[model samples]
Target: MSAYDAVLARQSWSKLTQEAPTREELLPLVAAAGRVADHSSLQPWRLIELRGDDRLRLGAAIAEANGDLKPSSKPLRASLLIAVVVSFRPSEKVPRWEQEAVASGVAHVLSLLLDEAGWGVIWRTGGHTRTAAVAAAHGLTENEELLGWLYVGGKPDGKRPGRRKPVDAESLLTRLPSAEGIAG
Candidate 1:
C-alpha cells in the first residue's frame, strides 16, 4: 500500500497474538523510523525491547508502583514491548520540550512502520509511567524519561471493529485573516 494509505489505515490493535517480529525484522524498521525530523540530529530517543521474563519484571514493577498487592499483567498483553525513552541531550538551541517531541515522533513513526509490516501495534502509557519503580525497572537514567511502550504482536485473524471516523479536514484547516480584517 502507498504510504498515505498505510497511514490512514493504521489503527491501534489492543488484542494481539503471541507472535511478534523477530529482532532481525525489527532493526530495519527502527532504522527507517529513526529518520524522523530532528533539529540537530540529536537522536534523543532509544527503544528497549522486552519479552518473556523482562515483561514479568516490568509487570511487577508496575504493580509495585501502583501500590497493588498483586503483580500487573499489563506488560504481558503482548509478546513484545518496546519501551520508548527520551534521552535528553544538553543543547543550547534545542530545548527539552522539542527533544521530547522528536522522541515522540519517532515512536509514532515506528508504530506506522510496524502497522504497515502487518504487525499489530499499540502505544500504551499511564500515570505510573514515570514513577520511580517503573523507571528503575527500565533502567532509566537521570537524563532519560519514559515516554511509553509499544505493544507489538501478530494481528488476530478476524474482522476488526468499526472503522475510524473520517477527520473533518475543512473544519480543522484555516488560513490567517486578511491584513484589514486583522487590523479591524
Candidate 2:
C-alpha cells in the first residue's frame, strides 16, 4: 500500500488475538520506523518488548503504583507490549522537549508500520506511567522517561476495518499572512 493509504487506513485495535509479531518480523519494521526526523541525530528513544511473565510483572507494578489490591489486567490485553522510553541526551542545540517529540514520533511511526504489516496495535498510557514502581518494572534509568506502550497482536478473524470521521483539512491548515498584511 502507498504511504498515504496506509496512514489513512490505520486505526487503533482494542480487540486482538494472542498472535503477535516475532522478534525477527518486528525488527525490520522498527528499523524503518527509526528513520523519523531527529535533530542532531540524537536517537533519544528505545523500545522494551514485554510478553508472558513480563506482562504479569508490569501488571503487578501497575497495581502497586495505583495502590490497588488486584493487579491491573491492562498489560494482558495484548500479546505483546512495546514500552516506549524517551532517553534524554544532553544537547545545547536541541531542547529536552524536542528530544521527547522525536521519541513520540518513533512510537507513532512504529504504530503505522505495525498496522500496515497486518498487526493490530494500540498505544496505551496512564497516570501510573511515571510512578516509581512502573519505572522500576521497565528497568528505566534516571535519564529515561516512559512515554507509553504499544500493545500489539494479530488482527481478529473477519474483523472489519474501523471507521474514522473524515478530517477537516481546510479548517486545520492555514497560511500565514504576507508581510504587507502584517505591516498594515
Alpha-carbon TM-score of each model against the true structure: 0.94, 0.94
lDDT of 2 at 109: 96
Relative to the true structure, candidate 1 reaches a TM of 0.94
Please estimate how well model 2 matches the true structure, expressed as its whole-model Cα lDDT: 0.94
Reference-based lDDT, each prediction? 0.94, 0.94
**What clash count goes with each model?**
0, 0
Candidate 1 lDDT over 1-184, as tens digits, reads 9989988989989899999999999999999999999999999999999999999999999999999989999999999999999999999999999999999999999999999999999999999889999999999999999999999998989947235788999998999989988894
Residue 91 in candidate 1, Cα distance off native in Å: 0.6
In angstroms, the error of model 1 at 164 is: 2.3
Residue-level lDDT tens digits of model 2 in 1-184: 9999999999988888999999999999999989999999999999999999999999999999999999999999997999999999999999999999999999999999999998999999999999999999999999999999999999998886466789999999989989999995
Clash pairs for candidate 1: none
| Alpha carbon deviation, residue 15, candidate 1 (Å) | 0.2
Off by over 4 Å in 2: 161-163, 177-184
